[model samples]
Target: MIRAEIVKLYKTVHTWIGVSCGLALFIAFYAGALTMFQEPIARWASPPAVGVEAVSLEDAPRLLELVAAAYPEAREEGITLHLRGHENEPARVTWVEDEPHEAGQPHGHVHWWATLKPDGSLMAKQEEPSDLAEFINDVHMRIGIPNPWGSYFMGVVSLLYGVTLIAGVIVLLPSLAKDFLELRIGKNLKRMWLDAHNVVGITALPFHLVIAVTATAWGFGVPLWSAQESVIFGGKQKIAMAHDLERWRAPPPTGEAGAMMPPSQLLQRLNAQVPDFEPKVMVFRNFGDKAAAAKFAGAERGYVGDTRFGGVILSAVTGTLIKDNRASRQDLDRRVGTVILALHTGEYGGITIIWAYFFLGFSGAWLFYSGNLLWIETRRKKARKEGEVEQSRSTRLLGSATVGICLGCVAGLSLTIVAAKWLHGRVADLDAWHAYIYYAVFLGSITWAFAWGAARSAVHLTWLCAAFTVAIPLTTLLAWAFPMLGMWAHGSAATVGVDIVAFIGALCFAWVATATAWRVKNGPADSVWSIRKAEGRTAARQSVAIAAE
Candidate 1:
């Protein structure tokens, strides 16, 4: 059995660490949950375009040749042949070219998609794809703070989070059997909340542990690499990384031009060789040269890794497998790394695992949110004297912050998602507008929370969350009903699923708002969550009644 003092010490450790890191973790987990369906979200946000089906696999050769002949730079930069026909793929063939800028300065790339026009001539346009999903991912990684600093902050938070997890487990060890799954839902609100938090924390312990470790590693990846170079690799880390990258790199082009193999034949060759490999896209370099190579980026069946990271490369001229870096062929170190990444990302086991991780992510976020509430409740009980009419300023401030940051993140993300279709063609840079809308709403909600106090702002922001989230589906509905709006509603299952999930989320938020409103009006007036200032009035009335008696 654990010692009482030891348990108390660990409890203190857990509380402080959790309180310090809970808000950031809530944002990370919430945004990270959305990213599980990043592809579907990307497809949902993408506008109608010349689809992958516009040019058949059989006709891909002609399209490639036309693009190569028209834009010689594409040959050197590599061209992508879309295979999955996802809604996000602008066309059967697409490539990106670096925008003109002075050397050694920060620059952007211009996205280009090529298709065969009605007259069989090359048709290409420079149109940027919707980056709403990527922005959400960025928020997940950086929590809306710019990189380097954000990464360093999250790294420290994740490290402390891991310590909190350990402290929590130690604190719970003595009562492990007795309180394992017991969730007491009764008049004792703090007891109920603590029970629920413990239950969820213990149940999803493994998942949380994986997340903590992976997040820390990734958050400090740059620093870790530098440390490894100095300490472990003796300055050979870059050389090692470069060598590892060689498996994915394409061969240099020969000056002499040669006949190119058709994309269909190359795929057939791919299938015969790597039967389990599903290619999403084939990236071609040196298209017309004798030494041309095509790198396939996709998933290998039953593998636990990202599609973008591993695949085979083929000689475009002879349809021969040039390099195989599929999961099965990966070196032990790479395979282990891939599995860890897949575990963190929920990339394995397909859709079922994705949904599992989705719910788990929300549960994790709630665990942190409730943890903060428990801390506030604990402090309130300790600081309050018998007839104290008000909560401590610290508790009140923390309460407002908790509600503001969490609900603000929710409302901001929902509204920004709704903006994807609404502002697509209307804005010169829809991507930049996404960031603008999210930050504006997020910061505004925080300010509102501080100004109005926690009780009122919680209800208000919860309602805002519901409204914004519901708008996601409503926006899609409007697009479907009115084509003149220059918006589109895709009929694909993936895109439709995004709308369905958002609608359900909106309903959940609405229910929470209603419950929160009821609590604010009717719950204990002495608490920060109660908007009514009835505590002082009640105490004075009791004294008057006692004197008369």
Candidate 2:
């Protein structure tokens, strides 16, 4: 009965839907997995990770002055204060500066940052390590493509993924019971892998569904509202842009003389004025005037609490609360967005959540790998039996693609992070080096796949990639072994957070390395291979009725 249902679904929409979204899903999971360790990766990118000390409240005002001097025109653009620093964090006062320029040419723009000394004085030279993180984020967000192109591309792929999620669930809804928890190995190799795939799919159904929908929403958010709703927008992107928090322009100030309040005081005033709120960023809406409004935005990292000010607009000169949305909106909407963002990024539950996210993300990637293996396994003896000419070329290509693209991405990202750390200070154009490394690795991976047989390189490249990523945190640990490179233990939570995450990442990499070794040596001859269950005869039998429907 279960076999009949599986065959039926295969004859219907199941195969097509999965294959259609498979590529996009692969990219998203691969990059999103990297995003799981964003903060730690960020710390690793900060070369010679320096220890941080707590900034005294008394020192904020003086430090603000030094930062202001460094960025005199900060008033014209914006000045932001970062209240927290990690173990290897650089205390940089950072902001974006819109330079003056004529039409058709970009006015000069710089996302400026300056590292501060331990004594509360600003470092003479400026450094912007966060750019590396942002670049990785952009790649994840929009495939590192620019403007409408990248976004539009990502949006289309995400929509397809979302559709696959819905369609997949519908197809699987019927057999969700009998076939679940059934993993058969060796009766028929294809049957075994299909069962393993079904089991993994069913178990992670909730997570996979969430990723699809959230990625869709994130990718299509702007287009759905602005482009599609242009009639409502009166054909003006500016109005839509204003509604979107991401929109920014050099809004000129009235230039009238008025006593502007300091951010330190503003932060305190914000907490006092709005109970249960924390400020993420304190911004002067206008750089030059009395009516210059201050906007503070924040929310608990996970979807646990309200946004710091919940989109409040406040008087820059005085802490007059303007707009607050603490309790007015639908709870479901808030939770949905927050949870989606948190879960997709593994941020909803803090460290535990991050670790869990990393595990699933990798598993999701492996699911694809195994799925490909199953496909290839099916065609192998048949192709040889019928001769290559009679065999399907499509399956062969997908087989190559699955191995090549997936392993390629892993190699690319690993190389990119290493390049970020190694190339800093040595290169005149550090940011350019960052970009070059990522693209080179990505392109190189694809080329390698075509040149070398996909199957052979998949195993080799993954181990190499795993080693590269693991090296980052390991290098940091070794570098700090004796308080070398001006490193000393700082009794700060943020610093501790950095070190702890690195250790965890190292462990994860070790696990991957082991998995790689197992795959290479013993081989996943059957669909489901577990280190723990290697001894049993037909013991791998567990299936979800999910797909059997």
Candidate 3:
């Protein structure tokens, strides 16, 4: 087939894909970029909920007693233990139970937690729902809808993003060699836009492709498997849900009361026995009972592999060994899960990976924006050449769709963050405030998308997003300027981490706005909302020359 033939097929598929999933893709990528910083942002938004006092292994028993007394159901059901006293991550005890609610549903299961008080009592405050983080996550996951549907929608979007990525690279393969230092501008704006889009799309191919495939797999993995398994073979939903829940398991406690060694003693033993690892959490199940076993799990920080370390359960009283999660070295699944979380959450390599993901996220945003630009450029040239006073319906609609969808994400995020800050003391329902902000911004952005031209909307909303995004961290920092806000500060690494990240994010967005403004300042004859118009002519000529090649 001729090159034009390939281009034609690609153009048709690409336009359809973009037109169909462009808004969804824009929300996913834009929100995902923010989701990368979910933890830090959550920490930043909520005041420290746990204390960092180091609890001696000896005192864990007393603390456990208080926790049992405080939340008996949680104690009887299951509780998580944290032993790392590092500043970034304070130690805490958490118990989960169907926290009784008026709705008679177990939706808000109380994740009761408490930090180790210096006096040995649990010292934890109820963790507030983090609005901004949750909102961003909802956008990434399912646009905040209920399960299966949200997951299903996200799954489809992820698949579309994957297809578009693959098809894009295929279309760019022929022009891969010639364009190096090229971001063309000037006459035949459509071709220039096409070339620019191709360059960014091709250059960021690896990043987008990796995220697309992984995300789609994550989104639809279980759903597709379940559908196929149920349709083709004898399978059940109960089995699948059970399998999912099995990763979270705890041994049933024995009611028999027997003399058990203190948790402090057990910790001493764990340190002596597992000399190479550092304990993170110790769980004493069936405490003071015949079936009691104390498991010591830690982070093996100095190792090449996963940071997670397993535990050896003892008879609490007899100090007899029970089991080791890492004894067979087959605990790779748990570790794999951790690494995947680290990848998605920017936790593994610490701040370096975190910053890398941040910029890559913005670059991801730009990748989509340039695609919208190419759409406009391609259509505009035809309209101009035909001496048609106006663009066709499809072009107008595409432009509106692009502006509404992409800019809506930015606007929604801005409004959400602002609501987070403003509703701190006012609203009883913070999550509701966040939802309202998102819904309102999103709806308003769509209206703007249709009302304002895509170019105008992109420029205007981007500037607005820049301002709002900057305001969030800055307002927190400015609130810091008062010094009283320091009272809200804690030794928790998560809290400090959140504040620092917000400031850094603000600076980065400032850079984005400044650069975009400069580009707009220096461009061609016929562009309305951009400054890079000068590169259009050279870009168009080169594109034709290559096509003729």
Candidate 4:
């Protein structure tokens, strides 16, 4: 058993770490949970005009040739053929181009799509796909901080998060057994919050640890890899790194043009070699060249690896297997790395694990939120014992900031998602509008929270969050209800599932808003959480002035 003094030391460490990193972690967890359904969200936000029938596998070669002939630059940069052409990924062929950089700005890129018209003619359009899903993923990865610097900042936060986890576990070691299942929701608000936070944190400890390690690795992976090359590999760094990256390299195209085989034939050959292989994306390199190559990337069920180095590369011309990296055929090193990635992504366990991770992510968010609440409540109680009228200015300021940031994140994401349908064809640059809408709402929420007190802002913002979230499902339902309105159901199970889940989310937000408004009206007058306290103080001061007169 650990000694009492050691437990006290750990408690301090845990408290400080949790409080300091709580808000950022909250953003990460909340955004990360939504990312678990990244593909579904993408489909829901995409405009219907972008949807098109996927080119048949046998006809894919013709489409490829047409695209290459029409856009010569694609011959060099390559093209990606989507095997699963759902509404979200409606186009059969896609490619990217680097956006030209300005004198003072960094470089960027855009996506281009090629589709077959009903008349069997090739049509290509340049568009920036709805990046709402990727935006959320970015928020999760770096808490919405801009890249380079944001990644490094999150890396440090991730390392400290790991330490915080260890300290929390140690502090709870003594009463863990007795209170493992305890959730005392009663008059003592602090105890209730402590119990709730402990329950979620302890139960999801393993998940939290995995998240911390993986987040740290991703955030700092570049620097760590560079250091490893310079320090450990020494003079052989280039050779060592090249050897590792060799598995991913594709052969360059020969200058001579060559006829390409149909993709169906190539896919058939891949399946013959690896029966369990299911290809989702087929990438062609150096189209219409003698040395052209294609890689069919997909996943095998019941395996730890998803798609990375888990499929076969083939000769696009001869339909011969060039390299096999099938899940069952991987070397030990590749297998280990694939397993780590699979576990971190929860990609192995199918839909069940996806749902499990979804809840775990939200619970992780709740854990951080509850930690903040506990801090505020603890300070309030202390000030009361000291016979003070209010808590410290810092505490009040933190309360307002937390309310603003947290609610802003929630409402911003919801409102931006709603804009996907409302602004699709009406705007010239829909993708840019998504970003503008999100930032405006997010910044506006912060301003409101600071202008109004925490108690009032919390109630109003919670309702705003509910309304916007509800709009998501309502938009789809309205489309279904009125077919002439140019809105219609996507008809895919994925899109339907997204709508259903969003409706449920709306209800949850509404419930929280109701509860928060009640707390503002009826909760303890000594706390900043109760708006009644401020009103009562004002009324008392007015009466005292009248009596003195």
Candidate 5:
């Protein structure tokens, strides 16, 4: 027979660890889910521009010559030639120039895109691309907290999360076979929620394990690297990393100008040499010099985990292969690391895997939310008797926090996404405003939840979530209907998919709000989630005041 004390011990460990890390994990998973569609969302938010077709591949050589002659910095910095005509790509050629700043201070970059005018002249303009996708990714990585601290904070949380996963399995082990898949929906609300939570937890355990390991590794990556350099690598880590980086770096420019190979001929050469490589963008360094190189960044056919760390470097003048770092050619250690990263990000298996990860992310978020609710319910049962009217302070406080943080994240993300279209050209720095708007709504919702009780605030914030999410599609509709409003709506499937998903999300939030409102009104009065408890407390206070008067 299983010992009662052992079960109790593991249950306590699981509960405490889960509660401490629940809020951060919720934010991470929800934002992470959205990041599965990061590129699509970026395309959806991007404004129409010069477009990739404006400068055809045949005329790219002329454009390169013009840019090299006009802007000497670009030749050294490298110029990116966009192949895919995604909405986010402003033109056929783009590059970044470092902004002027004091030597010791932090510097910024100015983004520039160039295209050929109707005449044969060079038309270049500096414009910032939408960073909404990157901002969502930041939230996923850091939970909206600033860097260094955020990384350290999440590193600790991820460690605790892995512990909780182990403790949870131990706690459920005695009855694992009997209760694993049996989700009983009945009058016992806590039992029902517990059953549902267990089902999801056990089903997605593998995915969670992968996430926990990868997240912990990445969260403390810098510190870990430092430790490894000192301890394991004997201070040779940086040198090794520099050597690895040389594969991606272009050769130094020779002063003598060379006869540059045409981009069309270079592409043919690439096809002949590396038949399976599909390059998304060709980055040219030292464009007009003898040592000019073209770096092709893209995926090779039938290989996973090759998007970020794979590609080939070719001589820009002669179209000769200079370097090959494709997945098949990577060292075993580097290849394993790349695969682990891809597994965490769901970069393999194409669109179907992307959707699977999206749902898994949501499931993970709900697991934490449900775990919080179960904790509150367990406390309520232990703390209260049949005659008790007030819930425990601990449970009440946790309830309020749970409702506040989770719903606040939802409402904040929705509102910030809506602002992408609504405040585009109207704001001086739309990127900064994205941060401002998200934090404002997120903090405001938490304050509202504390001022009102969890019972009332959950309903209000959920409705707010629905409204803001619905506004995403409505904003797009307005842009399409009335172009005079200075907004745009791209008809591409990727952009339209964003609107459709948001509309569905809005409906789900509305349904949740309705259900929560009903439970607050009709559920048990002694519980923290019941509005009648708050009402009874107010009535008792009024009676005491009247008696005193």
Candidate 6:
């Protein structure tokens, strides 16, 4: 009996925290799950362009010479050699040119791409690719808010989210074993929802905790770093920071003339030296100079944190190893930090881990979504006990907001992803159109939810989400069916997989829409989530009795 009171107290705390932060978590987790396949989504959005073949190891020397002769500044700023060519990447070499701003801060910069011509001359152009993947990533990181403020806001949400997790677990401890997998489906709608919510929340508790902690750390990293520098590091802060940065820096070039080794030779040398190193992108600093160095950044397979800048640096001229920073090369501090980041981002363990994270992310989204539904149902129970014909104004308002924000995120992300294909060449500024498409649909959903109330809007928005998600696959099929539209499949498995997953997602949304419509029309009439209104006081009590039965 004494333990029951403690559980009840925490339950109230859990409910408040979950209701307050559930919407944000829904947005973050849903978008974050999609972000697991960012590369595939990027390929799906990219239009056909002239593909630049990977520069041959032997021919890399000539390409380097041409770039050096054409852009002298590139010798200092560094140039990246593409290892794998795709529709989005049209150049063998790429670099950024900084654009100066009045405020003396880093502003917009131009991206330059270059390839070797048939006659051995360099062909270069300024390029802009669709930023669909990046936009989704931003939404996941900040829940569609802009910079520093967004980060701070998410940090606060994450902290609260952690507190809620603890409270929820404590409340569930007394009955966890008895109801861990229970999903009681009956006229008692609140009980059923609570069961589903508990299942997801508990099953994926570890994943949520990791995300909560890591998200807080990332969102507040700048402030935390500053505080540590000021308080802990103190006089040695600058020296320590410089030392940390130096480990990742490439050696500067010597001015003396020297012949650069072919890229193939460098690759072979790197493979021979590290044996476990797999080079993905090679960066050459101060090309053509005697002391020119190359940094090969790639993963050491089968290791956590392997993808985070784990490779060796070598002399571009002599093909000799200069610095080893492979996956296993990190010190204790960096290794732990990188592993935490990797776990949060799902950056390691290959394709299998990616799919696992993908599903877990969606599950997290569902947990918060069901949580909101439970809140509405709980309020409805209270109103019913009081013999009220309708749920309270606050309950109705929360229901509307919950449906609006959650479904808005779902439908908005789907439509924006669909826009990736439709708006590519049709718009003068495709990048801006991405934002326009998302916000228009998002705000439209929210406005609709508030205007029409939760019951009616829930059905409408679910159908809309189904339609938009279905459009993703239909767009691909239509592109193939009508070649005259100037869109064609890239014939890669990645793009094909995107269309397949989207089709499955559409089916899921359609099922949810059907289920929600049935519940709204036929479920408890006194509930804010129900569409059927009571004719009179007697009818309302009868309706409540019928629902309770």
Per-model TM values vs. the true structure? 0.97, 0.76, 0.78, 0.93, 0.96, 0.94
Best by lDDT: 1
lDDT of each: 0.92, 0.61, 0.64, 0.84, 0.91, 0.85
How many backbone clashes are present in model 2?
A: 17
Clashing pairs in 1: none
Model 6: lDDT of residue 205: 91
Candidate 4 RMSD to the correct structure? 2.8
| Tens-digit lDDT track of model 5 for 1-549 | 668898899999999999989999999999999999999999988988989999999999999899888888999999999999999999999999989998988999899999999899999999999989999999999999999989989999998999999988888889998997889988788898899889989989999988999999989999999999999999799999999999888999999999889888888999999988889899999999999999999988777788899999999999999999999999999999989988899877778999999999999999999999999888777766554567888888888899989999989988998898889999999999989999999899899988898899999999999999999889999999999988889999999999999999999999999999999999877778898997887887788899999
Q: lDDT tens digits, residues 389-492, model 4?
A: 55588677878888888888889888988888878778897777877887888889989998997889999999999999889889998888887766656767
- Residue-by-residue lDDT tens digits, candidate 1, 1-549: 788999999999999899889999999999999999999999999999989999999989999999999998999999999998899999999999999999999999999999999889999999999999999999999998998999999999998999999999999888889998999988787898899899999999999999999999999989998999999999688898899888888888878898888999999999999899888899999899999999999899888985757889999999999899998988898899989888899988889999999999999999999999898877767656665666788888999999999999999999999999999888899999999999999999999999999999999999999999999999999999999998899999999999999999999999999999999999866678887755555776799799989
The Cα error of candidate 1 at residue 9, in Å, is 1.1
lDDT of 2 by residue, 1-549 (tens): 436675466434556656655655666677777677776667556654432234454565455556655666776666655655553345434566766778788675756555557665676334455466777777777766786677777777777666655655556667767787888877476788778877777788889877777777777777677665567656676755466443223234676756667666777787787765555556665533676666666653334434422445577777677655443342566556555565566644556767787778867776666666666667655665664323255664675576567666666666676666456666787777777877787777767655654445555566666676665555546546754343333334543454565456556656765765575456543212222223332342322244454
The local lDDT score (0 to 100) that residue 257 gets in candidate 3 is 70
Which segments of model 5 are wrong by more than 4 Å? Answer: 1-3, 536-549
Determine which window of 10 residues in candidate 1 has minimal summed lDDT.
380-389
Candidate 3 stretches with Cα past 4 Å from truth are 1-4, 54-58, 84-91, 101-106, 115-132, 180-196, 231-233, 236-248, 258-288, 292-328, 331-350, 483-549
Query: Which prediction has the highest TM-score against the true structure?
Result: 1
Better of 3 and 6 by TM-score: 6
Judging by TM-score, tell me the better candidate of 5 and 6. Answer: 5
In what order do the candidates fall by lDDT, top score first?
1, 5, 6, 4, 3, 2
What TM-score would you give candidate 5 relative to the actual structure? 0.96
